[model samples]
Target: MEIDPDLQGSVESSHDPIPTVVAGPSGIRPSLYAASNTSASTSTTSFGIRDPWRVTPDFAPSVGSSSGRSVHRSDTWYPAVPSESRKFEILYIPDPSRAMMKKEAALNLGWTNRDITPAHFESIKHLTGLVYKTGRTKDRVKVLVTEWLWILLQMDLFENSEAFDVRFMQWQDFRAIILDPTNDIEGWNMLAKVDCIIGGIDYSVDHSGEGNSYHLNMDELARYESCVAQLASQTLFWPPIRLARQASMKWNTICHLQMIARLHGSYTPRTVRLSTGQDIPDDVVLKRSHSECAKHVILPTASRSRRTWEYLNAHTDKYEFWMAQEYVQSLDQIGEWRVFIVGGNVISVVHTYKTSDDGWKGTVTESFLTLDEIREIVEKEPTPIRPADLRRKIVNPESGAAPIRSRARDDFMGFVLTTWKHLVARETRDTGAKPSICLFCRVDVGIRIDMSGQAPPAYFVNEVERSPNTSIWLRFHDNTMGTLADTFAMVFKRWLMDIRNPYIL
Candidate 1:
């Protein structure tokens, strides 16, 4: 059933927190609009000057030589075409039947993992780093171009805003459904029943290559055909309907769950003004997109007749059986949820402070926790903890003690400085690069001393140093004015991106 019309006035839950893990004073960075304005020419543009795909009016002028002639001609370099390996998209499909199953069955059957996020879904923590590394517009082009065509093709795929046209199932749906994390094992096992497989099927780009020449490599296409052939030979493993239903129950439910997870993203409503100054929002409502009716069980005018026989017939298929959801625009509207699994490598380090100025203090407390300590805390406790708990166990956070002096703050800052030195030293020790630097100042000042009256330059305040000297008696102070967890979070996030496959150099 199409749910776009009835859910226009849906309201947000009052108790839910803001849908982002914002730090300090800022909100989560906003996601980009799925649609972008295209331009006629190719030229590199600066940030905020023009959209990534569009041409800008600003042009650079060439300088003349002493002879009053142009010295150098400006030429636009042609970017190389990207190989298909460098472009991919995360396709989504909704599976209501498997979502309805119990938690144990979900996990044991490989349905659900860590909290609510299914085992199949991977976290988006890697996206930012990947984008930064590749910066390829082809990734964007493939998704946007194909998606635009999918919108036009959906009309033919559906029958008059009712159920999916049984005979008109598209290969797009097959790709999406296979990628969805919530499909039931029994549902997949029943794939043999579908005419799409039994009938002579055409999924090759060659069939689609007549006009575009966007053909898959012969070796890759042969591998795909071979896999399909193997699956066909193993028909007993995934029999059609009745027999398959009985067989799927015998295997552990989690065993059927694939490593790939469902895409639980949503879309938000937005308006964009074109160069023509025309404003357009997502007003197109498609029946196949919404599932709110199934939530409320209130059939909409667009839904087909709720017939038992038809429901059962559709039950044999995955795409048609999904509960109707609503239409939205950007996927950013869907609140993200992550299931963090703990347990990783562990290391121990000691803070052998050489002097009193080697520690970091806070407004009330100080921290001596090393990165190894912090990583240990993250692994042991899956739930969120207060920033104060992450500090050195020596300081009493609840005491409400008076603030310390800037000198005391410097003394306590040793943990962070030493951690950075040790990390760089360990990682690139063989390169013969200098890794040690003054804690009070990141530069290799060479001399470390107690400068009682010395105050750092204004530029370093709230950054390299947080606590500024205010009074004579307060020689040591703490700067809990900012969240230390946030500082560490930024570092860890960057590290995660660097370590992932297809490493961003």
Candidate 2:
């Protein structure tokens, strides 16, 4: 069956079954097809939990479908199965043994013993195992995995180093060494040597093993060097302030230019302007109230907050308020839902919340807490408490039991799925057929309490993370039920399979 050119970008389609066969490295194959109009049904169980997985019958047809109808915009969008012939299967591997082996290998490779901690090795192993299990050629896997490890190591060094100027200088030196081909074996530190080795490995992958002795032409080398230098310089000069108006613009421009030179793409959290119906670059912080913005303002020179409206008035252009009508705010609580989507389906949901008094604006926290403990605090505390102040034992979400099913939760999940589909349609319309945006991504939804308290809380799209951090899954390995690693493996395997298909690519 051929997809209608006009309808290709839309997520909705007619009742026709589009045969899709998914095959993965593990050899498990599954066949999926779009559901017929009559087959779609929505029914609620006695527990009041709506089955979001059930197909809804009111889905609109794609532009070129037999009905020739377009989907209608509503307060909440609904999911529709696409007729496109895309399928994928997932394959996952356990990591404890793999991490141990890699730790030994790093030691033999002259890595400092102190730098190779168990936690660090495990992190490396998880990423490497992900690449290996997804069926990358052995040589390619080694090179890519090692490069990732090296990047992580560099990040750790920059973060842990006491002297920022010293670390910046080292980064400059490292960038110079990487760009120079003939400067071999003079006086370099262990980190510099490791950087050189990583570069060599990357080149070897590109040349299919001939890169061991390969040297780039002067022009190509100059361009590569320039790109690295720009990235390093930008990082060195990034503003310490969270959301300074001019500083953010400068940093974003540099980042975009660097990505262009590196042949990569970058994304920022989406910021929609309600008045102009346009997307502008801005950051939104949801707390107790919109007026709370006064409490969070940073002075031009220091980290302390300044109370004078004169300060803001002095810099009107640099401090304009860009509002999103969809911004979710509540009187007692502020939180967001993290919905993980794999192969166009919502696989997992995590609710992160903080009380109004906590002072922290977002869902993310440096400290950890279990769902039960968090629930207890919410139930008992008359005022919000910071997560860091909690003294209870930490429990990873992976080991915790499934969240108690509820209609409200189901509705939130449905809203997230719908938002993703809408965003995907917009992306496709803007940038033709790009497979990268359709794969695994995370959607963050901010929750706002209904004023009337007659229905569930309203959900608003906060942002979407295309490349979410995967280290959190490692915490779920010890779960008696299905671990997060298992879910990730399945989803990642499927994503890899999708990319491998020439049609999808």
Candidate 3:
């Protein structure tokens, strides 16, 4: 983990702006890669060139240098972490009965022999043990955990695939099941069973149960059900094709649906390299011209328009239109924090940084570096450098790659946890007596620049997922023994605590 400062410097300076090739008057241009080589050959004197998409070295100030004050806007807020600590018993062992139940559930879903692989069974067993620790009955645990598997399977089947028509059909059927639970289609599939499990969970807390047993009140349960329904109805059912169609015909509806998807946790934003060295057209630039500039100028109508247009057109001709999803465009950073909250308390936090090549839409890996360390790492070797390539350089030898602890880091964690608390509170207030808006879920918050005052940057929630992948568990226990066992134990423990001691206003 001892990175040579020289190596870091070399990497930091290596990111030269990618040379772009604009189409000439003939409407043809050399390939971007070829133009890049030509540009490099022409500009040997320019050193320390950086990609516009890559975060600058000074983009993130050192955490220690921050004022340590929580900056709140009228639209933004953060929740304070609880001072008290409670220890709960953890169960790591998998049960045979639960394993059998999972197999049965899988079979009931029409999973063929080929579909129910050993890996899927292992996943079921692991997850079942986790949910069992929440003090649910064998049957209840099986249903809940099985539903998780079903959701994951469906996401894998449809979301990542190009078969839009099939996804749309399946989603329509799934939406029906969610909206009307009593529909008794003869061949009720796994998703149908998932709907039933979600709809039927007894949210009433069983006060008579022994320690570690937990249950949500009816209202709390309803809230969770609503989230599941929305996820299925909005996210799953609304195919990309439908979204595109709505964009033109029903812009507002599309925006609302996109918001729901973001709230329910869609994929993390990744940066997109639209086209390297492509010039913006004059008409496109003029379309974006400010009226104030035209008003201030005193030249004759024709000359003023011509000069102003030419001046504005000069920069447009050399620009690259690197773009991201709307949600990403709203944020200021390429990294986001995934904070795991249970019972309104932050249990764990991980920083995820996106690679540069994909814009804001690429895969991210957990980074254990502190804000300062992260700055150094990015300065040295900008991401979307592959994780495998950056691992050895970013990991700290002393902490064995555990997340670095610092005052700035703590403040950030507090800010995210607090923001989530406020968001849940607002949801509850708006909904009025619904099930808890979020009993146990992951909240993804993007770090955004704040210029409202002299305050430093702040975090803004980008998405909330009721059933986020528990992959953080794997990353947290990477160097530990029985990582899978630990993952199940911790997940169940938090879930149980969340139910038993539900967050209150």
Clashes of each: 32, 0, 26
Error of 3 at 197 (Å): 1.9
**Tens digits of per-residue lDDT for model 3, 1-505:** 2222221211122222212222232221121001111111111111122322212232211110011122122213434322112322111112112233434534321111223333333434434322222223433332324333333333222322211111111223333443343342321232321111221211111211232122333343333345333333322221111221111121122233344436655333332222333442322212211111112212222244443434444423211122223333213234555665543444455555534563222222333345455444445543344444443443322343333444444545555554454454444343342122233455666643222322333345554454222233322323321322223233332332222222212
**What is candidate 3's TM-score against the reference?**
0.32
Candidate 2 off by > 4 Å: 1-327, 331-334, 355-410, 435-437, 452-457, 468-483, 497-505
TM-scores vs. true structure, each candidate: 0.17, 0.36, 0.32
Q: What lDDT does candidate 2 reach at residue 201?
A: 13
Model 2 worst lDDT window (10 residues): 236-245
Instruction: Summarize candidate 1's per-residue lDDT along 1-505 as a digit string, tens digits.
Output: 2222111321222221212122321221122111222222211111111211111122211111111111111423422221111111111122112122232232221121121111111221122211111122422211111111222123222223121111212333443323331343333333333212311122111121223122334443333333334334433111112221211221111111111011112111111211212221223222211121112122232344332334434322222222222222111111111101001110111121112353322122322223233344444555644333433332322332233333323333332233223333332232232111110111110111111213210100000110101010111223211122222222222222222212111
Give the distance in Å from residue 67's predicted Cα in candidate 3 to where it truly belongs: 35
Q: Local distance difference test, per candidate?
A: 0.22, 0.31, 0.31
The better candidate by TM-score, 2 or 3, is 2
Model 1: residues with Cα > 4 Å off, grouped in runs: 1-393, 397-409, 431-505
